[model samples]
Target: MQNLFYALTFERTLDRYSQADTTEVDVTAKVDPAGRTAQLLSAFFGLDEGLPRIADWAVCDGAGGKDGMPVIFSHEVGLNTLEPGDFAIKRRSGKLGEVTCLTLAPADDPGELRTVLLAGQFGSESDPPVSVEITGDIISLDQSVTFKGAQVAVTPLEDGPSLVLAEKVPQGQWELGKAATGIPFGGGSGCPEGTAQVLRVTWEGGITKPDGNAADDQERKLYRVTIRQEDGSEETIAPMHLADTGDGDNNHKLCLDRTEPVKSIAFPAGGFTDPRGDLNPPTYIGVSQRLIDKQS
Candidate 1:
């Protein structure tokens, strides 16, 4: 009985995705009406043309104390239509806070506009922020897709850099398409040879590992990744290289060595240093290969 519904759902989904209806998926969940998986898949099948999504929310800290939250988007945002009031947040205590200020972090570089530091009267240590929501009309610079009323979880202020995303592609391009059907980078060449997976290590605030005097000159290595071989042996490795999308967004694209199946990734203290000369604290991430956002 369950298979029947899904069988029908899959057929409609493929048909819907192939045609002009780019709004939402038209799948029937009446067979498993109470099934949360069916409901969720229905929502995902019908996306808003893969508009700018809430990528990350990190609490921004400084000498002024923990008074800011940095919001990262999936795509480049149009700054001409941006405002602090376009966003809101929900504190851990369930208190809603309004964003009173917004600015591009590391304002020196106008090229990188993905990280916007949102300022407001967020809760104190007793009730720090937990989530952020979009409230106003904001468009992506890449495709002019307006993403509103969407929310995502946030990282705390005291935390250091961590591995947040796993993708098949290194850049901001989506797995199958680019930026949810907008535009893809590169000349249509696919992933590099002998590559298995791509891990995106990101920090809450902004960071840089400068090779030379230039801001884009990057120092990529920052992780000690352990892989479990088919023979049950574990081999640890270093980040071979970093992803260069021509901007700083606290992302370290560590390309994996073949499909050996990763067991864990260990980030050492001082492995990464932010623009402010602060070291990234040590953190170990347990990766479940079964589930990952495979967007290359």
Candidate 2:
């Protein structure tokens, strides 16, 4: 016989402007019976978007269980608090049925975040009545019911430089020279006028096979480049393939002009292979172009 279970996934971001704190929270709950899966839903009232903006949220099921008989709720919250293994929770009881809650916390060593689990039921005979555990800060639930909402705190990071456009460039592929300009420089003081910058590129994007022939698609590959500045800051630039130029003989090269400064440059080979047939396709290449300046 098939049974029905209710599931709800909750996610929220917490932003504290005064303390510059931000965090992400993820909550998941599901009921399963026998071997079938059930639909999860969230019932929100009023016009508010539930909780305030947070860093992130995630949810999952407990270990070992099926559709409805044994349901589990797991929640993961990411924050910047020094005490990562601590949390505060407030819950409202469901109209009918049973409810369970569990709480899990991370260790004090500063690696994993804590967790909490809460489990309960409207009518059931179990030892310890409503049980709660505190391991660092992770919670686990065994019985089942439902929860209304949750809240947490987090930390925020100021505007910072990051690595973007770190993908492989397809081979036999060419991009326009004009497209090479406009690479974003890491946010910092400008570099000297005449310095040689270096960029190290790597392959990351996926490849596909259009024709059944393994050799034809294998011949197509990608390239990339990386840029490094004098201040130890760096950026990467990779040529994006516009379209196939037929066969693969008419390969194009996107070059940086001499007028442009060479801050950094690095190129890596692409790695791609075909699975359906017995052919190892060409690797993708990434090129990192650095802006170089002429010595005064």
Give TM-scores for every candidate, taking all chains together and pairing residue i with residue i: 0.47, 0.17
Q: Work out candidate 1's RMSD over C-alphas.
A: 15.1
Superposed Cα deviation of residue 214, candidate 2 (Å)? 12
TM-score for candidate 1, residues paired by index: 0.47
Write out the backbone clash pairs for model 1: 24-46, 25-46, 168-296, 169-296
lDDT of 2 at 195: 21
Candidate with top TM-score is 1
lDDT of 2: 0.21
In the range 234-274, model 2's lDDT, one tens digit per residue, is 65554222222121111122232222233433322222221
User: What does candidate 1's lDDT look like per residue over 1-296, in tens digits?
Assistant: 53345334421110000111132323222222122121000000001111112212211221122254556664445665566666667788899864444555332122234555555466556776777766655555443355566567766555544444332343443122211111111111122445456665444554544331212213444467788888999999875544433333444446665567777777667555543444567767666232233322
- Best prediction by lDDT: 1
Worst 10 residues of 1 by lDDT: 38-47
